[model samples]
Target: MTGVTQQAKSSKDRILEAAVAMTGENLGAGLSVRAVAARAGVSTGSLRHHFPTQRALQEAVLTAIYDLVIPDDHVIHDTSLPARDRLIACLRLVLAPAAPGKPSREAWSTVYERFIAPEPTEELRATYLATAREGLRRVEYWLSVLVEEGALAAGDNTRRARFLNTVVGGLSVERAMPGEASVLEAETEVLGMAVDAVLASREPGE
Candidate 1:
């Protein structure tokens, strides 16, 4: 019984990994069941057995993508560091590269494509919205932590989180453009400015 459960979990992980790997390049439009099944080394029938529909596969993939855990040594979780610095770390985290050509912007890029496509399917829209919302929730969680630590001024954390997500979204779009419209330095500078604007001034003359 345990062996069967382990095999099932492994198969699911492989499917999700294949979906993530194939998400870029075409903004997820290429993530058809046959393609994913081929990538995962499984039969289409096998994939369908696990996920009854394409929508189910998409939801599972997006969920798994967001569920990709940051390692314990991630900078944001370094509580010994200042909140402003930690927040900047988050900006860097989001701005990092996804594919060599694309940078770490595929999350927003795919969602944008889905949003503007000739009439997105409800499942596509819902999956992307949930993925994006989860990102904002993380920002809010970080802000609340900083607020508790007295590093950020207490306010409507939800709004603050949305604002941060907006900034990242803008950067993501820029990075996704044809040319090098958004450079890494510019991304860091804007994020630094935004973080400074939000953090509570603790020093006498900061």
Candidate 2:
């Protein structure tokens, strides 16, 4: 029983990893069960045993990507660091270049591309919206903490959180789009301005 359980876990992990790789290669393409099975070095039958269906596999892969992009260990609430600095660190983590061989940027690009599609399949749409909401929830939580810490004003934290999230999302889109050097530079400057504006809005007492 233990051996079987271990093997099943390993197989599932392989499927998730392969799905991420395929998503990275083509942000707009849907991952087929056969392609994922092939990448995982397993037969379709074996893959089905773990995932049941393509939707199940896709959701699992999407959830796995979310975990990687915002790992639990990330400092979402570090009171020692000023709120602005902590927020900046959070932004940097999301925007930083992927590790040498990892496909972090590509995975993020794929997620955003899927989220903004005009009409995704029901399952895909649900997955994208859920992922976006989860991100927003986390940002809101952190923003509230900052407000409680007196780093920000007592005004509407919800609106502020949404604004910051929108800015970040827009910047991510710009970075992913085909662009010339000037365009990329403009996107970077815009992100900087967004952050500066947020920081500048702090109350005098804060």
Clashes of each: 3, 0
Output the number of the lDDT-best candidate.
1
Task: Point to the candidate with the largest TM-score.
Answer: 1
- Residue range with the least summed lDDT across 10 consecutive positions in model 2: 96-105
List residue ranges in candidate 2 displaced over 4 A.
Answer: 1-65, 72-74, 97-118, 177-189, 199-206
- lDDT by residue (tens digit), candidate 1, 45-146: 888998898767766765565556432136666888887889888766665645324544565555556666547776556655656766776677778788
RMSD of each: 6.7, 7.1
Q: Give the Å error, residue 58, model 1.
A: 8.2
Off by over 4 Å in 1: 1-5, 8-63, 69-73, 99-113, 178-182, 200-206
Cα shift from native, residue 44, model 1 (Å):
17
> In terms of TM-score, how similar is model 2 to the real structure?
0.54
Q: What is candidate 2's lDDT per residue for 1-65, written digit by digit as tens?
A: 34544246587778888888886676456778898889888888988999897667766766677
Clashing pairs in 1: 97-104, 98-103, 98-104
Number of backbone clashes in candidate 1: 3
